[model samples]
Target chain A: MTDVLVVADHRRGDLRDVSYELVTAGRELADETGGDLHVAVISGTVDEFADKLNREGVDAVHTVDYGEEFNHGVYTQATTQLYDELAPQYVLTPNSVNGLDYAPAVANELDLPIVTDTVALETDGETLTATREMYGGKVETTTELEGPAVVTIRGAEWPAAEGTGDAAIEAFDADIDEDALGTTVNGFEEVGGGDVDISEADVLVSVGRGIEEEENLEIIEELADALDATVSASRPIVDNGWLPKNRQVGQSGKVVTPDVYIAIGISGAVQHVAGMKGSDTIVAINTDPNAPIMDIADYAITDDLFDVVPALTEEFH
Target chain B: MKILVTVKEVATVEDEFEIEGTEIADQYLGADLNEWDDYAVEEAVQLQEAGIADEVVTVTIGPEDCEQTIRQALAKGADRAIRVWDDALEGVDLLDVEAKTEILRGVVEEEDPDLVLSGVQSGDDSWGATGVSLAEDLGFEWAAVVNHLEHDLEDGIASVRRELEGGVEELTDVELPAVLTIQTGINEPRYASLRGIRQAQRKELDVQSLADVGVDEGVVDSDLELTDMYEPESESDVTVWEGSAEETAGELGDLLRDKGVAP
Candidate 1:
């Protein structure tokens, strides 16, 4: 039977939610290939990390105790070693920064084809088909890999795996090449001093490219204050330095599942939607009726945000 | 030190795009340099201006028309431009990361640059794989999604900060002769001045065929094919509210209260 391996992603001491999402994706792929689902976790405290990954549908948990933080060299070497041992038909990783760092190297070393940022996957016997969006999610293209491959799954596309199980945890050791470790992580610096965690906010008033100038953010902030909501923005606002990176919501930003997400003057690109589509309520305020944001919004106000925002702020107050 | 930047020409479709059979309808504005690559070109030019690098060379793998995009880069201060194309490459699927990576690998081999830079992802395909894969093939230390970059030419090391998911930033140092995939917002790319544009037109825009780049015939075949291309199904069920801004706001506030979203 074919086997599918998922490389779990973790930062600090906690397993990333994408790790469970990978499990969900792995289970489906394994089922399709009639294979067992295996998960590999590489960290200093492998046992502790592996314990948390004993979820249902996983047949085995492979643990490799390497450095504390994610070292691309360590991950690439360990994952390649594990792939050799398991000979799985498919290897899945989260398409995060850390995962992307090592996945390409591992695939290159093993000469295995790879597909990045895969939003969906399917299998027809031994043939694996992956679907990823292009042109800001405006176009969807389904692709098929020629053979066994490494694929990075986008977060939130697959539901996080749930329930616990007594999966066997196996320890694996790899001979890492010190010479190949050309990059070293010095440390992490919080972009906005780590004060705001928009992911946990219940109500998010997110702005985007249409906000025009940095000074216009005052109206958005006032509206956010009136509703006691958190202020978040799309990538452009954060990139333009108008908003701190922490207050940004999108694929490259934070994935927020707020109770209510109000998108003001934002054209919802696929990247932005990938992060906030899980919100229970979505309200879009834009002048363009055909703005992609309006397509997914529960309530759309096709008027200038300057006109709509101030009135909304006044009404809420 | 020679720095190499990879640019691409992408079609910008602002309106709704139509899917005609297996391909998208050709109803787009003329091609231009990929938006993300502009940041890479800007970074490379900045490094050159700072005397961190002796020269900045730009390359792209596209049709002959892509020379226009290369000229734009040269106008922005890239020292040289090379366009890798072949008549055989016309029908190859653009989304095939492997084929694209191989082509870029060929370019890297020929240039032997001290540093290679590319946009984190392309504007059209957005595969986000070519640069990293090329780095792997070249056995160079690499960093992806880098928003901030600084190089210590004497020490032969580069410091970079990655713009990761969830707004987390990680600082990493890589040895020089590395590949860095630049993210957007790293810097504001400069516009081409009239004099610069005129000078760019006079600069050599070299064209290299796939064979010239050592890519054997049929060796650059794509592993992945685009079986279909279409717009995603919309999940939106929006209720467009109409009225004066004030009235609409009042209605929205009442609705939010009814929905228990606001206090």
Candidate 2:
């Protein structure tokens, strides 16, 4: 039987939603290969989250209580220590900003080939294959990982499992030398001190470079006002000082999965969609019918945005 | 402030990249700066214009051919460009990112840059992991997928906006001489202008060899061996929606839910 390991991705003392998704992914791999799902959670107190993660499919949870927060060096070193001992056939992680930071170094150190932004992971016997979206969102590429595979599953790609299983909890003594960490977190800071950050918005009405000027942003803001939505944008709008960086959406900006995402005048680069594709509903209001945003959008208005936006704003109002 | 902006030479993002089975062939493919890295280069240029940084120096590591991308950065108003050329860096381990990082680390060590930046990910392999890796290897404070950056490195602190699920996080007062990986919404990666393009042609570039690093011809450990590189298999039959928005939404909802993707 193959052993599948999932690294529990958490923030603060609270567990990330993606960690539960990883559990579901772990369950799938374990079931396919006739092995138990062994989840590795690195935190200050793993017990605080055990009850929340207790599910039917998971065979066990490996809790590594290191600190209240996350440090890349400590995290990389700690995860490496676990991998050395477990030698998992498959390793799952969340494709998140935090997860994005440390997963590569661990993969490089372990001499493993990892597929990132993976939407799915399936196994045939001992061979574990992961599928990820490439070309931003145009193509889906699947790879058969060589060696002990590492993969970052796109958050929300797999539905969280509802089954509950009290497999077991184990703690292992892995040497974590503080001296090995080159960087330490003096303190943790929230990105937005207290402002209304668009990434948290349930629905977003975003603008792109096509808007032409910052002053004209009132037009998009009007749309946002109509829908009771927050205003967001692509990097151009933010860089031009039309909007705050906090309002930008894309790989370089933020990874957002809003309930509804509406794009006005955005061309839809892969980077932008990578952050927003997880949205439950997408609408594109662009003049270009071939715009990349239109491909993934559930509703597309292919006329001049100047005309459509005003009309849509009026309709909403 | 001196900002070190890094980029990679990759097959054009929209070039007809032919992926055959498990192998890809770059036949008739055009070369350009990776789009994500372009965002990094553009950000560096903007910082220079805004007087946030005194100068922007671009560094690139790839085969000898990567100089083109560096040259492109120079054309985009970069003060100068540095290219580390090595052919041995063909696989994932020795080439492109790892080699680029190795060269960048040396450049940063030499220049003691106030800020180091990179694109969130490169189009070549689409591995959105380099910025964080470089941050760790160089022992620099690192932040991933930042949509915004505002800081005074002289104060040893920086502020960045991290975009997350359903909101924006303001990661303020982070310590300086940090590495920030820029995502798409940080800046609109600018295109090369005519006057700038002509000036870039005359720019001086520093082309260094691995020999300069005392490692001689080859120094990469190549932790991961490339088993193969190929085109991806199609996941399912394509269903192009050609109907009204209501109809398309209804149809897509059914398909996605049927595929167990929708709630």
Candidate 3:
């Protein structure tokens, strides 16, 4: 049978939600290929992660208690060893920050093809058709590849597997060569803590790339001031140093479920949408009628922000 | 120390565009230096400026059309550039990670630089895999999504802060001969000065074929096939405020006040 092996992701202590989603995705692939779905949990409370990952669809849980946190070298070696032992047709992982660090190395070491950030996957047992986004989520494309391959699924694409499964948990003793490890993780530092916490705000006036210049941010700030709402931004604003990380909303930034999210000139890229999609109300102001932000907006004003924003601020005043 | 930076010219799509078959129509496509690579190039150039790196060379895998984009990197301070292209690569729709790794591996072997800097991912493909894969083939250490890098290379160790989800940064130290995929906001990428742009024209932009880079012609034969492409269907039932800028603003303001979100 063409078995599927999924690697779980965890950071600090808790298992990431994507771990369960990987189980769901792996189960779907396994069902399609008429094979068993095996999950490999490497490092950081492996037994606990494996236990939590033993959802209804999983056939087996492989635990490798290697380190306290994620280390790419350990993960790569342990995962490579597990792949050899299981001989699975597909290796599934979360297309997360940690996953990016090692998934490519694993694919290269195994000499297998890898398609990352896949939103959907289907297989006929001979070929895998993966659906992924390109050009910053402007277009969706279907990529096909045959034989055994490595795939990393985007977060929240598949529902998390539920209900406990009666599966055998095996301890995988990985022979990690200490000398081969060329990197050292010193520690982790929590950033984006400063004068303000945007996560707790009730209303957010978030601006994006269309603001054009740093000076142009004054209009957004004025609108936020008039409405007595917090001023936040998409990645480009923070990346350009116009806003602090604390005021940025995105996957890497804080997740804000504010009562109202006002997006100005934001195309609402998936990463940016992930942080604020849960807001009670979303309003977008942009010239592009077909911008991705409009799809998620409750109310949209398709106009120039420089003109619309000031007029909106006057209404609040 | 010598540092090599991998640059790419990404295709930018227009706001409203048409997908003809599996590709966007050429008329709707525009090319620019990949956004993430700009930060990587800046990092390498800063390392050279800080006296930590003696040379900053760039490598790109693209056709002659991308030379202008590569020159943008050179203008920003990369000493020289190497562009790897071949007639065999013209028709490959998707240059899979393996194919890119093999080609970059060929270049790395030839150059044998102390450090390799690349973007976390490209703007168009967003595969985000080439850097680490190339490192694996070269038997080098790798760190991904690095936002903060320490310029001081004490005892051949490069310290960096890897930006993880939820504003957490992992502090790591990698040995020499490593690849670090630079993330945005690592540094402010400088613009090309007029003099630098003129000087970049004189700088060596060595073009090589697959054979010249010691890569086989078959390396372009990627396993991944892009079968279909289309715009994603919008799932929302949004109420659009159609009118002049002031009218739309009034509609938004009315909605915000009605929702008790505005003063």
Candidate 4:
């Protein structure tokens, strides 16, 4: 049977949510096309992870533990060698920093067809049809695979599944070229040294260009404080020197799935949407209701910002 | 002071794209610069303007049509551009991520750049996979999704700030002559000014071939290939909410929250 392979991503030991999403989507494709779903785990003692994969409909888990930390060369070599051996019909990966770098290399080596940022996938007899977001998620396009395929899926494109796979863990010895790859991780030095989980926040008070001046941002900070929320902004605010670039949100910014995202004085841009679109609730507070942010917003306050923001902050208090 | 930048000409698949018989029915995109490389070109220009780099050479591998994108870069003020020509490469998938990386590795060897810059990704197939692959081949220090970047040629050091969850990833002490994949907002990528565009028409574009570069392209045989290209599918169902201000706000919020996309 044709097999679908998913390369799972993780930090120290535990698995991330995106891995499960890949399995769910991969399983769907495999089932429809008379194929079996497989997951590749490049980690340390990932038996628990393999069991978890089985629950997500994976037929088998290819586990390779080189060390406690991640090394690109190790993973790339193992994956490349495994694909050469398994010769699966389709290879799937999470569209993250790791997948973007190496999936193409393996696909290139094997001369396999590859698609990235796929949100939807289907099969028709002998072909694979995939969907990708374009123009800031404003449009979606379907693509047919040219041959055997390797692809990466955007985050949140598929929901996690509950269960039913063989869950067998298989460890394979693959040759890796260590000399060809260098650059060691000395240790983890957190950026800005903040342990905040922007992705899991309960409330997000985000600002965009609507706030106008850097000084005016204090008004937003006040509103955020009133609701006890964190502050975020669109890419333009940072580009204009109004806010630190770290506050910007979009395709290039942090992808947050917060419970409530309050866009104050922000006109939602496409890049911005790619980051926050997955949030549980989106509230747009802009003077122009026709702004792009309104299209996806659940609550929009259209009065002049000078009038409404104070009202929001006041009401929250 | 030195940076290697990779850019390509991608004919964006636009117009009425359709799928017929497992093939991507040709949609007329006409020829234009690949959509994502513009950000790469712009990022290189910004680094030079910000006084981050002493030199920036824009590079690409393709036919004469690829020159269109090279000049597009010159129009925005890149110092020089390199075009690796191989007429036999028509429809060979230079747009593919792995193929593009192999092509770039050749240029990197000849130029010996301190830093290699490619568009965060390309537009065709729009997969955004060049920086990682090139970085892997060269074994250079690298970073992607760069919103802010800084480099010190004298110390052979680079610092990149990537946008991550909640805060930022400020990676320092990264070696110079590294590979950088830039994000869209890196610096409000400048457009080709009227004069700049006109001047780019006359800029020197050095053309080289895979054979002349001491490399053989035969190693990569097209294994996984595209038998067809076609238009994306569309779903007709619509969920439009209409009403007064509160009614609209409430309705939109309810819909989003109902979808578990909002609170």
For A1-317, candidate 4 gives per-residue lDDT tens digits of 56778888775566777889998888888888678777888866577777777765777888886765555556677888878777777888878765665676566556566788888887753577778765445456666754478888987779886766767789877666666554343333344325555565677888887787889998888877766777878877877767654566677667777778888777776668778887766777777766777777766667666666665565545
Error of 2 at A238 (Å): 3.8
- For this target, which candidate reaches the highest lDDT against the unseen true structure? 3
Q: Give each model a TM-score.
A: 0.92, 0.74, 0.87, 0.77
lDDT of each: 0.84, 0.70, 0.90, 0.69
A best-first ranking of the candidates according to their TM-score comes to 1, 3, 4, 2
**Model 4: per-residue Cα lDDT at residue A63:** 83
Docking class of 4: acceptable
* DockQ of all predictions against the true structure, Cα-based: 0.62, 0.21, 0.57, 0.24
Ranking by lDDT: 3, 1, 2, 4
Instruction: Choose the strongest candidate by DockQ.
Output: 1
Write the residue-wise lDDT of candidate 3 on B84-135 in tens digits: 9999999789999999999999999999999999999998989999999999
Off by over 4 Å in 2: A170-176, A179-242, A258-269, A284-293, A299-317, B1-5, B15-28, B35-58, B74-82, B87-117, B134-143, B146-263
Q: Per-residue lDDT for A7 in model 2?
A: 81
List runs of model 1 lying over 4 Å from the truth. A193-195, A209-216, A225-228, A250-257, A267-278, A287-290, A302-317, B241-263
Q: Tens digit of lDDT per residue, candidate 1, span B8-81?
A: 99876665567776567777445879988999999999999998889999999888877877799999899889
User: Per-residue CA lDDT of candidate 1, range A98-155, in tens?
Assistant: 8878788788888877888888999864778888887767778887766688899987
Query: Cα miss at A210, model 4 (Å)?
Result: 0.9
